[model samples]
Target: MTTPADRGRRGKDARKRVPRSSHAVWVPPVDRPDAVAVLERQGRDRLTELLPIRYGRMSASPFAFLRGAAAVMAADLASQPHTGLTVQLCGDAHLLNFGLYASPERALLFDLNDFDETFPGPFEWDVKRLAASVVVAARENGHSPAKARRAAQETVAAYRATMRRLARLGELAVWYQRIDAERLLPLVRSDADRRRAEATLTRARRRTSLQALGRLTEVVDGRRRIIHDPPLVEPAGASDAAALRKIFSDYRSTLSEERRLLLDRYRFVDAARKVVGVGSVGLRCFLVLLTGRDADDPLFLQIKEARTSVLEEHLPHGPYVHPGHRVVAGQRLLQAAGDIFLGWMSGPQGRAYYWRQLRDMKGSADVAGMNPGALWSYARLCGTALARAHARSGDRIAIAAYLGSADTFERAVTEYALAYADQTTTDHATLTAAIAAGVVPASPDV
Candidate 1:
């Protein structure tokens, strides 16, 4: 067994291969793949009709482009030198990806919520993506470049500090670490910010399945039926519904025995094909409504298609071969507490899909409208949450030692973030140009 001292030495030794100071550099390779081409490749296997919506959403802003261009960023990061410290990355850890969600115990916790592109890779990749997002968001919000750099710096500092703190704790203590939503109020300085935070939490609590039932379903012919919103949300056809029912049991088998018993109590009522997220717009996604006890008690489960991680081609293969299983396993390992219904199963045509509650008190911050102070605070919180997640799956002791007490890594990452934000801006423009030139179809109204 490696001792703590040995672990510390290992982290320190990594600096020789990739010095912490080297992280600040960001010069895109001359032969970097065209951003639109990368996005088009991702759309090939997706629902072709929905591809327009994806391009339209991503073309809205530079940050939106970054959100949808994980493939582009993944390739860029792979070309750079890294610390070689591996962790199960939240592969697309942009600002909006960190959010508030309920634990199995019903407590509200804030953590990394998206895992579609999650895979094992150098830990710094997640950090760089997150920092770059902060800069891009800050710029879009009209903050000065200096302010953007500061926000990104605070983010990395919080991550480094949190990692070091977690390294000093016992294994179980580190595993149990989490940021509770109630604690967020005290972290805010002004009453206005505190009230806003409280309101956000309250709003999230109201986003339960029962709320969704009222908002997304209506009584027709004495039965609760999912409301159709056209291309965004439409009822599944007879054949699609039949396929869902067939695979329901296989998905249930992936759950724990107790959870399976609990799931058995609910009767499947309806299914719908729903478009979701910027990057996931074209992917096959479905919403399953189940009723427990009575019609008023509703449970909405989302079955989303899972593709190989954007980082998969850049790094070594991970343990799980099945894409759905990979997403489910990564979520379980990285989350402080996971959903009871988290599961995976092969769909028709051997497509991979993962299942989870559609909404259980989940909410994300509106980064676009946030002031500089608010953005910095939120960015730091995201950084802390990310460190806690990484500590659970990677060598915290080594990472902490590598980061040290100095702010060198933070400063370097801030510099890289600003540079990468420029790249994202350029990439966003490229996509917009493609849409303008009729090279890509986009539906901005959607």
Candidate 2:
């Protein structure tokens, strides 16, 4: 087995090839429209009827636009000088994507909650994506450019600090470390921030499967069934339901024997094609409702389609042939504790999907409404969370050495974030133009 010391030595050797100071440069490209076009093409395979809703959400603001343009940004990040230090990336890492979720022990843990675009890639790619998000979100919240830069800098700085701290620890220690809800309280800067965090946690605790059933389903002749919400949450056709059952069975085989036994108690009742998130709106996402013991005891599972990661187009080919398997593997590799039902399946026509609980104490940051102080504090927390994740999969010692004690990497990343934020605004305008010219279809009703 490769020991932690061996990994640290390897990390030190890597710094000799790519110095940490080299991270501080950004070269703006002239051919940005091509990247924008790539994003438009990515949406081609999605559900056509929901394309309007996807575009409508993306067109709301530059931050929202950036969230939907992961493919575009992935292409851009690949062009930069990468260190060749690979980690399982949260390819679409952004301010709002990190959240609170229940771990196996029923504790609320704060970490990266979205992994739709995960793939093995350079560690810096995740950092740059996150820093750019801070800038974009700050702009969307009407904060000054100086505050935005500060927020970005704080994020990078926190990552640097956390990585440095982790580099000195044993590999097992790093792997075992986690940021739970109680630990997250110290990161809050003010009393108002504390109250907001508490409120969010309180709300998340109540967002259970039974709660979702109460809100989303109704009793028809004493039988509860999902309500239809056109273009958002609607019943799957008979043919699709058959395919889904097959996929669900295949997914069950991927789980452990214990989990399978636990799952066997629940009987699948109904499923709906649900529209979710800015980028994933047009994709095939199903909310499956299952009941155990009685109608009062419900379990909600989400089966989301997984395509080849956005990063895969730019990076080398991954080991897994099935994208669903790739997503599950990446999530397991990075998360300290993942969902018990985490599994993958191959569906009809070679479509791939991963399954997990729909909601169990899940909560996310509201970046668009955050003040400067709150944004700064949130950036630090996200940075710390990200560093721990990277340390588990990448060379923390080498990354820390490359970053150093000085503010060199932080300044460079902040500069890159500013430039990228500008590019995001320009790209958002391109999308808006496409919609206005009827080159792209969009709906406001969503």
Pick the lDDT winner: 1
Task: List the lowest-lDDT window of 10 residues for candidate 1.
Answer: 183-192
Q: Model-by-model lDDT, in order?
A: 0.94, 0.87
List where candidate 1 sits over 4 angstroms from the true fold. none
Which TM-score value belongs to model 1? 0.99
lDDT of 2 by residue, 32-102 (tens): 44745786689889888888898899998898898998998888887767888888898988988898899
lDDT of 2 at 379: 95
lDDT of 2 at 290: 92
lDDT string, candidate 1, 63-163, tens digits: 99999999999999999988888888999999999999999999999999999999999999999999999999999999997899899999999999999
Clashing pairs in 1: none
